[model samples]
Target chain A: MSEAFSGPVAGHVPVLRLGDVLMVTLQGDLHDSTAQQLQQDLAETITHSGATGVIIDISGVEIVDSFLGRVLAEIAAQASLLAARTVVVGMRPAVAITLVELGLTLPGLRTALSTEVAMDLLTQGAPRVGVRRESP
Target chain B: MPEHTAEETHGSPTHEVRDFLRRRREQIAQRWADEPLFRSVFTVSRDEAVEAGKAVVDALAEVADAGRVDDPDAAGFSGVREQLARMGVARGRAGLTAAQVSSELATLRQPVENLLLSDIGEAPAEHVRACATTLTVLMGTLRVVVMQTALSEGEALIDRQRLQLLEVATPVIKLWDGIVAVPLIGTLDSARSQVVMETLLQSIVEQQARFAILDITGVPTVDTLVAQHLMKTVAAARLMGAECIVSGIRPAIAQTIVHLGLDLGTVITRAGLADALKYALHQLGADIVGPTANGTGHR
Candidate 1:
């Protein structure tokens, strides 16, 4: 969270805005502070950029400790509250096993095998289960 | 019995045993072939048993020469270890207890000792006793080697059978364009359940399947642990961007699960394979309908 205070100073991991969809690709070993900052940044970007969807690519990440898993869940939850859908994509087989063994099922998060599928899901509106609507 | 061989100048037990074995190798092999252990294994040909016996004698002699006859890892034992393990397993299958097998091996030493008595002409009591003790120690080590090898061989065989069992137990089959199913049979052990999860996930990825059905129709029982395993697999499949549905939960098993207070709410389950397939089909906006009266309604 020092990174959150520094404001993108260690901006190694960039959250790209693609046609109103935010794409965050996590690569290699992510520091705890980096994940915290990313969570903050994603929340802010979803609010400011008016992005309707978020795609988190984790193919390059070999391990997802419980902290990172909770962070991913948090990112999805935060995006949901802001009326943006989040589809995590490109999760490696090992990472899935580790997360499942760790009991961090990331209950509210949606996952896709590939980025294209995630993008497709992001584009489709109210087509499947787990679709959330804002309370009046 | 004077303690003297023509070649004995008060040498070590290793030297004496090695010399004695070399001199009486053929005679000892012949006697051992008639013993129950070799006799049972080499039932086809007596010559075959004699050859196996010769190999063992040679290994023992080599070990004694190396002065490592008491060590189970003695290099000489490796040659005969596989054959010894087979003999031990066969004996075990024949309903002989381990103590009985060890005693059977003790019978083999008597023939060699009888020869030793003739070889050591006019030998001193102390020298003769030392030679006999060395031979006994060597045979004891051989018994240990056989037991260790047989135990490990048994474990390895079980491991192999388990792999084969899993191969037939869990198979991921594609049900539709974006759906797959795994019909798990038998019991849900920790190892097998983990494999079930892995194979289900792999099928989901390779087939790009949006839905996976784990049909446990053939699984006999459902305990709290098994329920937890099913939930874990469902959760894992979801993490891989697929919805996992557990089906074929017997009515009795379902009641048991609820009684055990297992929370299966996270897992979407179906009554049977057909129901699971129907649920998946309906989710995919597809359905099955029977033909109407005129055979004109088969859509």
Candidate 2:
């Protein structure tokens, strides 16, 4: 889980491909620039790998400011465009409070309690009644 | 020469004043009892009134004996202030108004003056003047103490009211077996939100509720801050493993949210409490299944 990414750039978000699902585990504080770069990298990975589902584990990120919140939403929106379902997993309690306080409700964003649950949600195929999903 | 030696042999000027007051204690107290205003104004029992009057005279004597007659808050006058404050609180609780107490205190001086004049008839002119001045100053200190007690009583009342308001503002109610709703009213500041969050979370665990509804209909408006407070509450509930449903979005509030472009994320929101409850019930896997004798049941 603590493995580093050997990509061209240092501190680049590690995007691991798991079978048909692409898993990106976010750790520590995410600066605005870091979020922006992650957004671009996630979109590119989803397109090149042809992944049908993208799971983002954010249990490690301590604070989700408005900018980072927007980036997460953009990632989810972009992944869906590339025919992939995006599920954010493991949002901490304090992070959730800060996110709401920032007034970034992450509207239309899909979330799960853990990476396991996120995987379950992805494997279930299609979202429930009110949950947002990629249009068929 | 005899008078000067008598004064020098005595403890101090305060000693002379205290000696004079002690000698006339019974007389001053009797005069206080005889005053028409004393009986009319004081709400305590006749015996208690007499006792309180005697205590005041004794306290004044102690203040004069300490020799710092000009300073009411002096350490020497502490006992005097304590006696007067006790009298104030006792009379206040007995339904006596501060005005009545003030007027009664004024009448007390008349008796002391009469006693002072009669006692001064034998003393030298200079000694008489010094004693009168000390007694007058001590009386003023008593009055200050009484006023302070009145202020403290009013402050206590306001503090209790604030607590009552907090209790009334956030009420956590069990809407169903596994659902709790916290109806928030009034302003939602950081303080009130903290209380709301604590009460809701505690209720969730106690009721083992799977769903919580935060009905904000009583909340008059939805600004960015208010919306943020609501969002924080929902997030906290989610952490507790209970689904949160926000209800009571008026037309004006909906407009405000859209105008601000605030994203509530995927937190479920409904138009009214009933709708939120309906959604909560569905999430709990409970169907109405037609109203039954035992209320409703889970399918």
lDDT of 2 by residue, A25-131 (tens): 88887656667777888888888888999998887888777778888888888888898988887676566656656666665677765576567668767432222
Which lDDT value does model 2 have at B298? 32
Top model number, lDDT: 1
Clashing pairs in 1: B1-B122, B1-B123, B2-B122, B2-B123, B2-B124, B3-B123, B3-B124
Interface RMSD in Å per candidate, to 1 decimal? 7.0, 7.8
After the best TM-score superposition of candidate 2, give how far the Cα of residue B69 lies from its true spot, in angstroms. Answer: 3.8
Off by over 4 Å in 2: A1-136, B1-3, B9-11, B34-44, B68-103, B223-225, B256-267, B291-299
User: What share of the reference contacts survives in each candidate?
Assistant: 0.45, 0.09
DockQ of 2: 0.09
Provide a comma-separated list of chain B TM-scores, one per candidate.
Answer: 0.91, 0.80
How well is each residue in B1-299 modelled by candidate 1, as lDDT tens digits? 33455335858867988999998999999999999989987889999999999999999999999999789999999899999998889888899998888888888888888888778756667778889999989988988988888788889999999899988889999988778999989999999999988888877879888889999899899998888889888888889888889999899999998899998888889999999998887776565778779886624
